[model samples]
Target: MHKLLLVMVLAAFALPARAADPLPRATPESVGLSPERLARIGAMVETEVREGRIPGAVVAIARRGKLAYFEAHGFQDGGRSKPMPRDAIFPIASMTKVLTGATLMSVLEEGRLSLWDPVSRFFPAFAEMRVVADGNPDSTVPAARPIRVIDLARHTSGIVYGNRGTTPAHQLWQRSLGGYSRMSGGDFIAAMAKLPLLHQPGTTWEYGLSIDVLGLVIEERTDKSLGEAMAERILRPLGMQDTGFVVPEGQRGRYATPLPKDPVSGQPQDVRVGLVTPGFEGGGGQAVSTAADYIRFAQMLLNGGTLDGKRVLSRKSVEEMTRDHLSPEIANNVTLTEPQLTNFGFGITVAVRREGGSDVLGSPGMFSWNGAYGTSMWVDPKEELAVVFMASTPGLIRQHYRRVVNALVYGAIAD
Candidate 1:
C-alpha cells in the first residue's frame, strides 16, 4: 500500500503543476490590455503587498470607457484592519490641478475668462508686482509683463511653495499666512496680492502656488467659491462624486490617512491629514478623491472631452489643453530643471516619450500627475490605456510603483 501511494504522488507531481493558474482575461485582442496581462499586473501588485512596501493600494485600468482591470490589495490602515477597497478615497494632492485646469477650460468655453487675461486686471495688487532682487526684501522691480491666466496654468507666474528654497516671494509667502494657511480661496488671493511676483509674468517657468491664484480668478469671474464653481462646471458632470476638498461628517472616516515620514526617526508615521479644514480649500492641493473618481476624470480626457454623455469639454479644447503651450525653454525647464521628474503640459505633467528620453514607456504626449500622498494616475492615449495606483503613503513614489504598473500593463497586452 505504501509503494502504491508513493507512485501516485510522483504521478501527481509529474502532471505539470496545473499551468500556474490561468491568467485573467480582460479584453479582445484588438482592444486594450489582455486578461493575461492584467493577471500579471495582479501578480506584481500582490508581490508588492507581500513585500510590505505598500500597506494597501487600489489599482484600476480603463480602456475605451471600459474597466478592464480593477483590483485592491493590502489594508486601509497599517494595522491591517480594513481591506483596501476599490472606492477608497485619498487626498489626491496636486492632481487637483487637472480639475482646476478643466474648470478653467470651462470658463474659457463660456467666454467668461480668457487665458491671456491679465491677472492684475482682476486683482489690482498684482499690477505693480516686482521680482526679488539681490535677496532684498523690499527691492522694487519694473513690471516686465502682466501675469495671465495662461501663466498660472503653465506655472510661469512666479510663485513658490516657501519650503524648497528662499526668495523674496518665498519670504512674502512665508509672511503671508492669510494666503497659505487660510482655508478660504478668497483670503488666499487677498494674501497673494500682498506679496510680489517672483519674476516677470510669462517669461519664466516657476512651479509655485500660481494655480491657487487661477482658482481666485475663476471665483472672481463666476461670483462663486472655487468648490461651487467646480461642482457646477466639472465635478458633477464627470460624476466625480467623491472628489472635493471637504469630506462630509459621515464620510470623514473614508479619507485616507497620510503616512508622512517622521522627521526625527525617519520612519513611516501615521499623520492624519484631514481632507476638510480651514486651510486648504483654494490651493491646487485641496481636492480629495478616489482612484475611481480620478479614472473617470482621465477617461473624459481619453474620450476627447465627454464621458458617459457628460460633455465637460470639446475635443478642440482637450487637444489644446494637452498640447505643449509653453516656450521651448519652459518645456525644457519643466522636463530638465524644476521638478526634474517630469514634463508639464498645461495643468498636467506630460511624460516625455523620446526613445531614449526620461520616460520609460509609451510615446510622446502621455500626461498624468500624482497627489502628495502617493496617489498616481497617467493616461497614455497613444497606447489607449489609463493606469492608476492609489496608496495612503508618501514614500510609495520612490518605491517604483509606477515602474511596475507600466511594465505589467504593457506586458499584459496580448499580440
Candidate 2:
C-alpha cells in the first residue's frame, strides 16, 4: 500500500501544473519533510488564533515542485464564521511588486525595455526631477541623476511612501493618496512629478513610489492597464487566477479581514484597503491574491522561471532578480531600506539573504517579500522549497507569524 501511494503521488507530480484546481498533492515524507515537524505549523497557528493573536490564516508549502503541506486555521471572523478556506484571498500588498517586476522583465526579455533606461524615456514628466535639500522640503536641487528603470525595480529611487514621513515632501506626496484608488497611469505620473524626491536617483534604498511609476511605464508600453499586462505576461501564463487588484464579486466572501482591533492596544483596525483595491493599480501596493495563486508564482521562481513546461521568463532574468543588484559602494543600499532587512539585500522586487548576518535559518540566495496586511512568502532554491503564509493580522501579530513560519518550515525540512 505504501509503495502504491508513493507511486501515485510521484506520477501526479509528473503532470503539468493546473490552475483551476489544487496543485498535485504529496505526503510531507515523500518530499523529505518530517510530518511531525510540519504539523507544528498548524499547531502554532491554532494557538495564535485561540489566544486572540490573529483572526485566521492559510499556509501553503511546496517542496520538490509538489504541495507537501497546505492548511487553514481559524475562521474569517474571530473563529465565528466558516473556517478559513484554502482558497481564501488575502491582499498581498507589496508582494504585488514581484508580478510587476516579472511583467517588466518579460518586456525586457523582448529587448523593448532596458534596466538602464531612464523613466523619462517613457514619461516625460520625469525628464527632470528634484531632490530635497538637507532634509528641508522647501529647499531642493536638480536631481543629481535620472531615475533609471533598474532603480525602480530595486527601490533605490528617491521617491518614498508618503505615509512614512511627516515633512512637507511626504505631506505633498500624501495628498495624492486619496486619489490613487481612482487615478489613471498618466495622471499618477503627473501627480508624482510635482513632489520633491527624498533622495537623489539611485542613491538610497528607501521604499516608495518607484514601482508605481514603473506601472505607468508598463501602461505606456503595453497600452493596457498594469493588471492586464501582468495577466497577459506572467499571471495568466503561471495560472495565478486569483491574483489581481480586487477580488471578484463572487469571491468577496473568501476575502480575509484583519481583526476588528489591535489585540494589545484595542484600537480599531480598519484595513479594508489591505484586501481589496479599486481604481488605480498601484504597483507598490493595492493588490490582492490567494495562497494557492501565489505559491505557483513562488514555484516558478524556484523552477528558474518555468513551470509545467511553460516559460514565463528566462532563467537569466530570474537569476538577475534574485541576486544582490546593489554594490558595496552604494552607501545606503543595505542600511536605509525600510524595515531594515537583516542580512538581506534588495533584489528585484524581493529581498535576497546574504551568506550570514540573519538570525533566521535559510539559504544565501533565498528571495522573498511580504505584504503589510499579514501576508508573506519565500522561495529557497537550495531547499527546493516555497512557502506562502496568508493572514490579515495587519499589526505586530503579522510579524510574529512570519517568523513562526520561517523557523518551523525550515525546521521541518528533513533532507
Q: Alpha carbon lDDT of residue 277, candidate 2?
A: 51
Give the TM-score of each candidate: 0.84, 0.92
- Candidate 2: regions farther than 4 A off: 1-21, 274-277, 333-340
TM-score for candidate 1: 0.84
Encode model 1's per-residue lDDT on 190-288: one tens digit a residue.
676666666667767666687788877888888887788899988898777887777777886666653345323468676444443746455476777
Best by lDDT: 2
RMSD of 1: 9.3
lDDT of 2 by residue, 138-214 (tens): 89999998999999998888888888778787887788754665776667788888778888888677788788888
By summed lDDT, the worst window of 10 consecutive residues in model 1 runs over 15-24
